[model samples]
Target: MSLRDRLFGRERRSAQTARKRLQLVLIHDRAGLSPGTLDALKDDLVAAISRHVDIDASGVHVTLRSDRDKQRLVADIPLAPSRERRRELG
Candidate 1:
């Protein structure tokens, strides 16, 4: 069968691939970071930030954010603030 027919037959795979590619392309365009570059940046970011603050390194999220004409590297790095956890402190 053709590519279109195959994709239609397997909806979940098609949808997953589309979503993954869309996110990848959008992040690349927004932050001018390719997949390889983004990986390197993520490694560096985790290492650099660890020097100052204690982070939930495993749960840290780094992504490109865009609003209007502005683009920024949004790092949702979860960290314990000195003593209490976020749910308790906030």
Candidate 2:
């Protein structure tokens, strides 16, 4: 380790962990929901989406991220091809 790492190791403060933990707190506060609530909502969304569409559930990424002036619920869902697409190609 370098001089900086040695000096910081005395107290063992991890900047990355602190930043990520604070971010999680802020996201839940801004969204007015706990992390568990967010997880429940995500599950509901996945179920609803899967009922009518084909998607890669494991590839979904959901988070509460900040926008310009407000917090937003962001989701990245990977969808499989639909019948309409196959028809168009045929």
Candidate 3:
């Protein structure tokens, strides 16, 4: 990251990774989707998101997480700054 991005707190790598993990854990803990379905969902999600913005393909992380009685789906999509991607490569 550039010094400027760091100083501006543009999401440290560790924090971003943890957030993605936590979100996935929450959803899996609650919904209990099968592995195959989950994988398909993640792929579809990446495809959908890519249509709107440029993303780091290798860095995409999608998961479900749970906390107590709450659960949510988390997708960590590292974006390419100021770029819009027309479509995602499947």
Top candidate on TM-score is 2
Off by over 4 Å in 1: 1-27, 80-90
TM-score of each: 0.59, 0.67, 0.54
lDDT of 1 by residue, 1-90 (tens): 579867788545677889988976886876768867777888899999999998778887777776677778888888846655755777
How far off is residue 57 in model 3, in Å? 1.6
How much lDDT does each candidate structure score?
A: 0.78, 0.84, 0.75
Clashes of each: 0, 0, 12
Per-residue lDDT tens digits for candidate 2, residues 1-90, read: 577778777544578679989987988897898878888988888899999989888888788887666898888999976789989999
Write the residue-wise lDDT of candidate 3 on 1-90 in tens digits.
888988998857887899887776656656978557788988898888889877787788876666687666778888875523334431
Better of 1 and 3 by TM-score: 1
What is the clash count of model 1? 0
Model 3 segments more than 4 A misplaced: 1-29, 81-90
**What ordering of candidates by TM-score runs from best to worst?**
2, 1, 3
> Which 10-residue span in candidate 1 carries the lowest summed lDDT?
80-89
